[model samples]
Target: MIITRAKEYCIKILSSSNCKKLPFHNLSHTQEVVEHAALIAKETSIDSEETEPIIIAAWFHDTGHSKTYFGHEEVSKELANEYLTSVGYDTKKIKIVLSCIDATKMPQHPSNLHAKVLCDADLFHIGTELFFCKKLLLRREWELEKIKTYSDKEWHKINLAFLEKHKFKTDYGQTVLEDMKLKNLEKVKTILSFY
Candidate 1:
């Protein structure tokens, strides 16, 4: 199907990139998001039509990281638009994919189920067993990119605030991930105690 083609295209594009600068948002991260998106979509029982754009959006979501460090979502849209249009993807559907990608921008505001799924999938790590591991990678990437640097204590405080502020949008996320995220938050707090 076209979704498979889109996957191949995205894989090729990402593989061809010199992704050394992208410690976190690289192919591994993209693949995780795609898998999470697909799993979330399936658990929600969304039909293929909905799943298509969600999967497509997942694959292309972080592709902009190959181009720029910040505001990559817009470049993601341009790349998705160019590729989808070349493949003669339905305009309405392409819009859906782009919107899904946009939904992942921080302080994410996802209006639709597809966008919600994509957003949750994009951040699936926050609720997983590896939040700290992922967090370390993200922190390193941020330092490498000169976005910001924080001592472990400072970072833990910031992470605690973030975990407190963040909420999962999807019902599956709220039900399945929320508990783990809360657990992670408490763990963060516990770690901060030593600092």
Candidate 2:
């Protein structure tokens, strides 16, 4: 499948990168995104035709992450185009691919079906048991980047506030993923008391 090929390429990219600068953004994260993207594709009632584009988008979504520039979504799309074009992925499909990558940008609000699917897939980790673990890694990444660091108390407050602020936008997300989402959030809430 196209996604499988794309994911393989992403793996190659991750394997080739220096672990120091791109510690959190690695092959495991790309694999998780591909898995979740496929899950969302299955659960979302999106046509099979939409599947490859979404999956390919997910695969290449973070490929540019280790580059000198911090925000790598655009470069990821460019990378996708470069690789996919050589393999005969249509140019038109590349536009949708670009849209899917952009959908994952922070403060995300999907305005199209492709965007919605990609956004849902990106946030799919929120419903998983490892949601808290991923958040911790995110915190660590932020610390490494010198973006911000919080005390234990402050971190707990920040995590809880962020979780509380998030609401699922799609019916598929609301129905199937929402319960797990709440459970994940509650786990954080429970941990906060210990801090």
Candidate 3:
């Protein structure tokens, strides 16, 4: 299937020298996004054709992090366009995939259902048990890149504020994930209180 092919392409690119330092935006993260996108799509009753672009976007969303961290979403979009075109994916579907990737950008504001699903999938970990673990990896990635650093207490505060400001766009996300996310926010607050 095209999704499978796109996943393989993503894996291959991530394994190449170009993606040597991606502690957070690695293959594992991409796989997680793909799985979350599928779960969200299934829960939302999105059609198979619609799910295809979501999955493809999930695979390629961070592929540009292989080359650079700054403005990687645009690079991801370009790469997705190039790879999808080369593989003969339908033009309409490619556009959908691109929009999905775009929706994953920071301060995400998705314009359509596929983009909404992708946005929720990309940030799904904020509502899961693995949230802190994934967050630690992201922190480590940032430190390694000399982006920024934070103490445990500071990180807890930052996460709490982020959770407070963020909201899931999809019905499944709002109904299923929001509670967990709120619980996580409280957990972070509890940690901060101890500090």
Relative to the true structure, how large is the alpha-carbon lDDT of every model? 0.91, 0.78, 0.90
Over the stretch 6-123, how does candidate 2's per-residue lDDT look in tens digits?
Answer: 7788878877874335546667777787787777778878787877788888888888775733678878878899999989988878888888888787767666777777777778
- TM-score, structure 2 vs. true: 0.87
Q: Which portions of model 3 miss their true places by more than 4 Å?
A: 18-20
Which 10 consecutive residues of model 1 have the lowest summed lDDT?
A: 13-22
- Quote the positional error of residue 172 for candidate 2 in Å: 2.3
Comparing 1 and 2 on TM-score, the stronger one: 1
The residue-by-residue lDDT of candidate 3 on 1-195, one tens digit each, is 998888888889877845656688888888899999999999999989889999999999998887788899999999999999998999999999999999998899899999999999999999888898889998999899889899888888888989999999999999999999999999898898898
Number of colliding residue pairs in model 2: 0
> Pick by lDDT: which candidate is best?
1
Candidate with best TM-score:
1
Candidate 1, residues 43-94: lDDT per residue as tens digits? Answer: 8899878899999999999888778879999989999999999989999999
Clashes of each: 0, 0, 0
- Model 1 scores a TM of 0.97
Q: Scored by Cα lDDT, where does model 3 land?
A: 0.90
- TM-score ranking from best candidate downward: 1, 3, 2
Candidate 3's TM-score reads 0.96
